[model samples]
Target chain A: MTSLYWAVADGWTITRRDLTHWVRQPTPIILGLLFPIMLVLMFGFLFGGAIAVPGGGDYREFLLPGMFVMTVAFGVEGTMIAVTTDAARGVTDRFRSMPMAQSAVVVGRNGADMLDSVLVLAAMIGCGLAVGWRWHGGPGATLAAVGLLLLLRFALLWVGIYLGLVVGGPETVAAVQILVWPIGFLSNVFVAPETMPAWLGTVAAWNPLSATVSATRELFGNPGWGGQSWIAQHATVMAVLWPLAIIAVFFPLSVRAFRRMSR
Target chain B: MSVVAEGLHKCYRDKSALDGFDLTVAEGRVCGLLGPNGAGKTTAVRILATLLRPDGGRAEVAGFDVTRHPAEVRRRIGLVGQHAAVDEVLSGRQNLVMFGRLYHLSSARARARADELLTQFGLADTGDKAVKQYSGGMRRRLDLAASMILAPKVLFLDEPTTGLDPRARNEVWAATRALVADGTTVLLTTQYLDEADQLADDISVIDNGQVVGNGTPDQLKTKIGGDRIDLVLHDADDLAAAAATVSRVTGADTDIDRDDRRLSAPVRNRVAALVEASRALDDAGIAVEDIVLRRPTLDEVFLTLTSAGTGHGPRETGRE
Candidate 1:
């Protein structure tokens, strides 16, 4: 019990350290928050006219849920950049050398990034409201949707940590950032995958991001991709299962990568 | 001993970072691991600091086995790596306080410790400033201060002043000396031989991932040779004659510099060797332009000890 207490305390200290970074350099956080907002406005106004939702459903309602999922997915890059930068700077090594709990560093990183993800979700939701996006699902369903978004962000946290340790520097964060865009656009974030070629559409519909987007649209009582595919039919279950699967694979992988750094 | 390691080995692909490296550092004394690039100085320090596990052999630090009891070793030792590891976005005070907090100090105690270290390291004035604004020297000092948050029993500093100006180097040296004065055992690694001469109580000379030589700075200097008598003659024609005369007097092989019309030979007695060489060159009708006998610096010891013909590969002054 005492050991667990100290681990939490140590992890909280590192989280606070990251929080202080947010306070000290408000530019990056503000810019990061602005990025998704800019995307929402761009896709909603500039590109929304071109994107036709089937049955003439409201594009804003369909796009908002997908946008929330994209916002959460985009978090992977920031976490990767922060983690790799710290590793390159040797701060991670410094923490390893100290008498702190082994998991504290990663735990603290997840905590801080999750907090950032929450703020990001709040900002995107506010932007959605401004752009005439509304949810007809009651409060419980809305809460579940928010919960799913956070879970996806949490799972991506481990993926970012693992890749950050593997890459070992900030220079590669840009490469990872570039890869995130294709993943974002390939899913149901903008156009319904069904509009693509049948094979390509199947791949996109199976994408983990698609599951979260599809599930959240259902929870938000918004328009979703109308498909008879098993993945689309089981979107709600897949939403919870996909993040859990990601966490299971990458959590240990990330911890192992972190250990391998000193070796 | 605060630390001990034997036959520790680490291989990174084709390069052996630590090859049967051995070290022993007595309590409350600074032991400098002197070496050039790729000499395993950093590798050895990392292993001892509980950051890396050696591929072979055994090690103990601060009475805990590094591989088996890393947590305990970590508690007793502080490591300041080759780079300044403090958070760049955080203030100096915040960085130190964060480190203290990670060590499980209460909030108030952590704050107090941060202030104390800031004052001790002469960073009090700029403690509130973001670390990104700190000069390189200031960052290094803060890095050192952060490592000492718990007043660790053993401190591992890997090239603490590698890229600092002489003035900044002196500041770090002063701070290190103060730490030693408080009975903190230090293991400092450096390419600068003079840094070891200034700070290390005992010096370990590493080359090719092994301890080629180890002793007090003076003792290692003696291992290479005693004072050297350097003679610059007026004409290149007199070089051979001067070399023979100096060799005859010192009973050591003389190294010649044809461009400078110079020859130098190691000698046991400083003043007597200088006077004797001067008289011998004068008698041989060799017009001497300059002659001096000076004690061997650590630079010469490192050169002689790590030179290609002596032990390692072709001499490449790591500075270049």
Candidate 2:
């Protein structure tokens, strides 16, 4: 029990270290928050006119939840960069050498990233509202939609931490950062999968981001492609399962990678 | 012993980083692991610090086996890696307080410890500045301060002054000496022979993953040879004549450097050898500009010890 207490204490300590970074250098966080807002403005104003909603609804409303998912997905890049930087700078080794709990580093990182996700999600929601995006499904469903977005963020956090540990050097991290964009664009986040070719549509519809986007669109009472496919019909179920599956795989992998470092 | 390792071996795929490495550092003394790059100094230090497990070896730090009781060993040992490991975004004091918190000190204690370390490391004036704004030496001092938060029983410093300027290196050396004065056992790895000579009470000279030589700095220097006589002749043409005269007087082979018009040879008696060499060179009309007797430097000791195929020659000088 005492050990468990210290482990949590150590994890919180690490989390605070990251949070302190946020306080010391607010530019990156501000830029991260602004990037999604810029996307919202570009797509909502400049590009929303060209894009059509399949079910005949406001394009901004349809695009808002997708933007939220994209925001969460984009978080992988930040997490990866942070992790790799720490590893490269020998901060991770310092933590490993200390008597702190073995799990504390990752746990603290997850905690900080999750907290950052919450703040970003809230800011994005405000951006959504200012752009005339509204959820007709009332407060509870909106809360559920927000929860689904954070759940996806939580899952992708582990993926980021895992890849960060696996890939060495800043150059490799830059490549991975570039790779995240295609994965984000290939999903149903920006455009309906039905607009693409049949095979490409299937792949996007099955994307983990698609599940959360489709599910949150439903909970928000916003228009989506509303496909008749079984996977499209089960967006909420997949939203929960996709992140759980991700956590199941990458959590252990991240822990194992941290332990096996320099061995 | 505050730290001990025996037959520690670590193989990274086809390359062996450490092969049968062994060392022991007694309490409150600095043991310098002196070696050139890739000589397994860092690898040996890592194993003793409980950061890396040896493939085939037994090691202990602060009475706890590194592999078996890593957490216990970690509690007693502090490691400062080659690079400065403190966070760049945080201030110097913040980094120390964060590390102190990770060490499980209470909030107030962590804060107090941070203040104490910042002052001790001479970082108190810059304690509130973001680490990114600090100079390289200040960052390194902060790294050292972070490791000293718990007043660890054993401290592992891997190439602490590898890239610092001479003055900055002196700052780190001074800090290390203060730590030793406070009774912290330090296991320092450094490539600079002078760094070892300045700070190490004992040194283990590593080469190709093993201790090639180990002793006090004076003892290691003596292992290569005793005092030597050097002559810088006034005329370059006298180099050959001076070498012969010095060798004849010292009864040892002389090293002749025609470019510098210098000749040097090992001698048993410093004063007598200098006198005899000066007299013989003067008799031979060598036109000696200068002659002096000096002890063998640690660099020569290192070169002679680690030169390939000098197998077990220098090893005999190490503690058995």
Candidate 3:
């Protein structure tokens, strides 16, 4: 029981250390929050006119849920950069040398990053409202949509941490940032999958991001591609299952990767 | 003994970092590991710190086997690596407190310990500044302060003052001396022979992944030779006469440099050799520019031992 308590305490201290960074250097956090706002305006107004939703509704409304998923997905790179920087700077080694719980660093990193995702999600949601995006569903369904988005963020957090440990240092971190884009655009975020070629459309529809976006769009009562595919019909199940599956695989993988660093 | 290692070996791909390395550090004394680059000093440290496992052999630190009881060894040791392992974004006090908390100190105790360390390491004035704004010396001092938080039985410092200015190096030296006074056994690896001379009670000269020589600083210095009388002649023509006079007086092999007009010869007794050489030069009418009796430095000892194969030659005066 005391060991469990100490883990939580150590994890909270690490989380607080990251929180101090947010307070001391607000520029990066502010810039990170503002980048998505810029994207919302660009895609909602500049490019929204050219793009069409399959089932006619406001383009901003259709784009908002997709952007929400994109904003969370984008967090993967930021988390990876932070982890790799710590590893390169020897902070990871310092923590490893100490008598603290081995899992505290990852737990703390995930905890602080989850908090960051919440703040980013809230800001993107505000940006969505300003651009005339709305959800016709009741409070419970709306809350469920937000929960699904965070779940996806939590799952991707492990992936980011794992990759950060595998590809150490800043240069390799910049290289891994390139992967986030394909994972982002190759989903249902920017365009309806049905708009692409049949094979490409299937790939997009099956993306994990697509599951969260499609599920949230359904809950928000917003217009989406009314595909007759079974995956589209069961978006909510896939939404929960996909993240759980990712967590199951990547969580252990990330912890093992972290342990392997000492070797 | 606080640390013990025997026949330790480690290999990296096609390179051998440690080949039959051995070390033993007694309680409450500093054991310096002197070596050039790629000499396996760091590999030995990493193994003892429980950060890496050796491919072969056995080691114990603080009464626990490093491989079988890493957690126990970790609990009793502190390691300060080459680079400062500190958060640049956090203040010195915050960094120290965070480390204290991670060591399981209570909030109140952690804060108190941070303040104490800040004052002890002369960081009290700038404890609130972000570490990014700190000078390199201050950052290193803070790094040292961080490692001392737990007051472990043993501490490992890898090149603690490798890049510091002389004054900052003295500051770290003083801090290390203070730690020794408090009874912490330190194992320091350094490339600076003078650093080992100043701080170490005993030094193990490592080269090519093995201990080529080990002894007290004075013993290592005496390995190359004893005190020597150096004479610089005022005139180039006086070189041979000065060398002949010093050889006749000390009855030792004299090394003469023609261009510099300098003659040096090994001496058994420093003051007697100096007096006798002065009288001999006066009798020969050799105009002496300067003459002094000097001892061999650790630099010469290191060069002789490392360059001399097997380090078991007749010139290798000290062993064990």
Candidate 4:
């Protein structure tokens, strides 16, 4: 019982350290919040005019829900950058050498990043409301949609931590940043996958980001591709399952990586 | 012993970082692990600090086995790595408080300890300034403050003053001395022989991942040779004559440098040898320009021990 208490206390202490960074240096957090807003405007105004929804529905509504999920997906880069910076700077070794609970470093990082994701989601939601996007579903479904987005963010957090532990330094994080774009665009977040070639569209439909995007579109009562595929029909179940599966795989990998840091 | 390691071994892929490494540091004493780059100095420190586990052998820190009871070891030990490990974005005071809190101090106590350490390390004036704005010396002092929050029984410093200017290096050395005065057992790894000569109670010379020599500074200097007398002649042609005179007076072999018109040889009695060599050189009409008798320095001891059979041969000292 005493050990468990210290674990939580130590984790919160590390989380507070990151929170202090937000207060001391707000520019990075402000820029991270602003990037998704810029993407929302660029897509909703520039590409929304020429694009057509699968059936008859507004593209802004379709784009807004996808933008929320995309915002959550992009959080991996921030987590990776923070983790790799700590490792390179020797801060991680200091933590490891301390008497604090062993699991607190990664756990605290996840907690702080999840909080960042929530703030980003809240800002994107406000941006959506300003640009004339509404949820026809009641408050309960909207809350579930937000939960699904966060669930995806939580799973990706482990992946970021694992990669950060494995990667050599911050220079490699830039390559990971560039790779995020291709994976982000390959999903159905920007457009209906049906508009692409058949093989490409199928691949996009199977992307984990697409699962959250499709499920959240249904929850928000927004326009979607309205495809007849089995995966689309089961978007909500896949959304929940995909992130759980990711957590199952990457969480252990992350813990193992942290433990093997001595090697 | 506050820290002990027996035949510690670590390998990185095909390369061996530490092989058959052994060390023991007693309580309340500073032991300097002196070695050049890639001699496994940092590797041995890491293993004892519980940051890395050796693939073979056993180690203990503060009476706890490093691998089996790392938690216990960590609770009693502190580590200051090669880089300043404190947070750059945070102020010096904030970094200390955060580390204090992680050491499980209560909020009020953490703050009080932070203030105390800031004052102690000479960082009280800059305590509120962001560490990024502080000088390199200030950052290193802050790093020391962070590690000392718990008044750890044993502290590990890995190359604490590698890049600092002479003054900053002195500041760090003073801080380390203060810690030792408080009964903290310190294991410091350094490449600078002067640092070891100044701070270490006992110096261990590591070469090729093992200790080549271990003794006090004076003892190690004596192990290589006793006091030596050096003479610089007025003319290059006098080098041969001076060498013969000095060797005969000192009863030792003389090394002659024709380029510098210098000759040096070891002596059993420093003053007697100096007096006899001056008279002998004067009688031989060697025209000696300068002569002095001095103890062999730790640099000479280090080169003589580490440079054996490495093919580079022993280089000249006083180059730096």
Top model by DockQ, which number?
A: 1
Error of 1 at B279 (Å): 3.4
**Candidate 3 C-alpha lDDT tens digits along A167-250:** 877777677667778887888888888898999989999999999999999999888877889888889999999999999999
Docking class of 3: medium
Tens-digit per-residue lDDT, A40-138, candidate 4:
899999988998888968999999988888788789988998888888889999999999998889878988999999988999999999999999899
Candidate 4, DockQ score (0 to 1): 0.82
Q: Which regions in candidate 4 have their CA more than 4 angstroms from the true location?
A: B234-262, B275-287, B308-320
Query: What lDDT score goes with residue B215 in model 3?
Result: 89
Q: Chain A alone, TM-score for each of the models?
A: 0.98, 0.97, 0.97, 0.98
For residues A160-241, could you state the per-residue lDDT of candidate 1 as single tens digits? 9999889866568888888888998888889989899999998899999999999999999999877888998999999999
Better of 3 and 4 by TM-score: 4
lDDT of 4 at B176: 93
Two-chain DockQ for each candidate model: 0.85, 0.79, 0.68, 0.82
How high is the DockQ of candidate 1? 0.85
lDDT of model 4, residue B31: 95
Report the lDDT of model 4 for residue B216.
Answer: 90
TM-score of each: 0.96, 0.95, 0.90, 0.94
Q: Give the poorly placed runs of model 3, Cα more than 4 Å off.
A: B229-291, B307-320
- Residue-level lDDT of model 2, residues B1-320, one tens digit each, is 99888999999988999999989999999999998889999889888877788999899899999999999998998899999998999999999999998998888999999999999999999999999999888988999999998999999999999889888899999999999999999999998989999999999999999998889998877777777777888999778777777778877778777778877787887888877778887788778788888887787778777754242222222221
What docking grade applies to model 1?
high
Q: How many Å off is the CA of B195 in candidate 4?
A: 0.7
